[model samples]
Target: MTSSTPLRIGVMGAHSTGKSLLMRRIEMELHGQGIPVARTGNLGRRAALVPLPKMQHHTLASTTWVIATGIADEIAAWARLEKGPVQVVLADRACWDALAYFRAALEWRQQTAPRAEREALHQLAHAHGRTYDLLLATVLDPDVPVESKHDYDPRYRTLVDRHTHDFLREENIRHVRVTSDPASQELAIEHALQLCMTEAPA
Candidate 1:
């Protein structure tokens, strides 16, 4: 937060796991304190418009596009400070999110991505991930039904959640995990606020 670049807070998880809701809560809290934030999101919807495969059918190309585009979006969000100061950049999906979805897709299809290609993507995601000041990853709760509006494949969704955490652990990336519980959500909000407010505008 002390850096001229805005503090980047990213949230990542499965499609229906409340990633957006958690980010929205943080955004509201920052705004209440008069902290400016820029959010980058809707990557999945945007990818589909690009006619790239997603979800259960996510491919290496699509995954690459998603991650690279997310990086660009984050850079753009940071660049917004030139026009006006933005204290934080709230990224709806962190760079590794697409890789997780792709990993899940491979598992769902019983296919394996080439070792080199997979490793390269991981390197790219890992590099971008280091820039985040705070990252929140949501845990999927299968007991809670997804809203009918989203026609997600339960099996695919579960795999995505599993792989998301798997990648986090494997990479040893530091992040706070948010669950469905209200208490967990509140703690995450507090943690994020503390990170931003420490160097935020008074």
Candidate 2:
């Protein structure tokens, strides 16, 4: 890829599934290969769109959702601007899944709202899916416990995971499933790198 058109690679999985760690590792590996890389987390802690009231109340979930969505929008804008081949862009979150999860959350909150809100959330979810270049599914071993203190409902977690996989399959996006093993993590990074390299312009 040229300096202007970076290959975007996304790493997605459940919270505390080593998504951040894997992203760091990928950066290191790409650097070793002399590849220029730009990396960002799926969700940022301090996104600007977070309402001041929500920040004052320490609304972790809302803040996270806003950050994640912001990153997606930002990346999509960047891709549109850089029309030539460029370095690699590795994102630690999957934008499409985040949109879906947020849509689910919004619908739950507006359970009593008019039908228009429901339709809007659905439209938003569909729009978000078209933003990403690829979706990486970071699979946690079923034995691993969900340890994040975040209040994501257990049922919601299950639903998002299933939906994420289904979305990737439907989009025909290249995905690498990283197991809990150390070797598997390395392999996953390698697989992602290969995908990035292949997509790069000759």
Candidate 3:
């Protein structure tokens, strides 16, 4: 099951939306099944520069560079190194999430940053959306608390979801929604694996 193109999957959602948990579960499940899987996430509290966890073995660049450069070259670089077919690369924060976060952050930055800098950031957000493959969105249950006040804006989450949907639809990328349920996570994982395996040599 060697693929010509890498299998890139993004587990994305707002704060405390269980994105990290889902990623961990998926990695464990895949590894248990003897699949080659790599999982990583934003381990730091600061969004400006978050590093991937050590368990994933991925050397992710700072979010600052991702925001500055419209292209997701860091992730792209890692994706190109598959020794065999069907290498699963899972990231907590993908280009889609980065775009969503950037859009939300834009409003706050607009109040302080110069006009040129604001425009550049917006362009970067758009570029991020164009580079992603699949987007797995997690819908949060109402009972969970926000990880941080800055990441808790319901309006931003809604807007980001809408934008994400548009990008997926426009690009024709596979997008799936998983509620805060273990069963749902299992189903999503199966579907995503099928897509990765069944897609044309990629």
Candidate 4:
């Protein structure tokens, strides 16, 4: 809570869509390109306490916890920069990104979140999302194949990927969809840095 929130750019996508890859490269790209920006390490994977499917009866609770944790972490990161020279906060994942995964979890449970419950929770997420100036959404490349993660089954990754793509469009959140190509991750990082600088204060 300060006079101005740090310029936030959140990277979003499914498990293997290079969110972390971009997260790692953003700080370097900014510095290498001589763009002064502070960055937050990826908490998207680490913040999961009670996972979606595992929370069966308390799906809403788990969703709230995970999403809240994400926003809280982002805010904390921003606060850490108050006295520093950094003005832009490049975030790997955010509450909006959490919303995408939460939806995918709902589907995995074979149960729909009651409209009222879903709306209330998502409204909170959207409120937190207001701090973000840019959202870079990466898509899973068909040719690349989903990289294996111990926690993510191939089917679940696909499901989460579909929902993540749909949520951004359905919610009308302003975002740019970046495609990971057969060649390398550098393209994605360069593309993200380009988007971040669009409105970056620093």
Highest TM-score against the true fold, candidate:
1
Which residue pairs overlap in candidate 4's backbone? none
User: Ten-residue segment with the worst summed lDDT in candidate 2?
Assistant: 51-60
Q: What's the TM-score of each model vs. the native?
A: 0.95, 0.64, 0.62, 0.80
RMSD (Å) of each candidate, 1 decimal? 2.0, 5.6, 6.8, 3.3
**Candidate 3 regions with alpha-carbon error over 4 angstroms:** 1-3, 43-86, 107-133, 146-174, 197-202
Instruction: Give the winner by lDDT: 2 or 3.
Output: 2
Q: Candidate 4: lDDT over CA atoms? A: 0.69
lDDT string for model 4 (4-41, tens) is 55677788777777777777677777777766576665
lDDT of 1: 0.90
Which digits, one per residue and each the tens of the lDDT, describe model 2 over residues 26-95?
A: 8888878777666766344544343332212323255345544656654563454355433677776755
In model 2, what lDDT does residue 107 have?
A: 40
Question: Candidate 2, overall lDDT?
Answer: 0.58
- Candidate 1 segments whose C-alpha is farther than 4 A from its true place: 1-3, 81-83, 200-202
On TM-score, the stronger of 3 and 4 is: 4
Sorting all predicted structures by TM-score, with the top scorer first, yields 1, 4, 2, 3
In model 1, the Cα lDDT at residue 54 comes to 84
The candidate scoring highest on lDDT is 1
Measured with C-alpha atoms, the lDDT of residue 37 in candidate 2 is 69
Worst 10 residues of 3 by lDDT: 52-61
Q: Kindly list the per-residue Cα lDDT of model 3 for residues 1-202, writing each as its tens digit.
A: 2334456677665556778877787777767766666665643344334533211111123334544332344355346545544466676666556544444444433434456754564566556554445668877566655656553456655555555455556656567888878788889878766765565242
lDDT string, candidate 1, 40-159, tens digits: 999999999999998999998999999999999988886764557777899999998888899999999999988999999989998898878888999998898877998889999999
* Local lDDT at 34 for model 4: 67
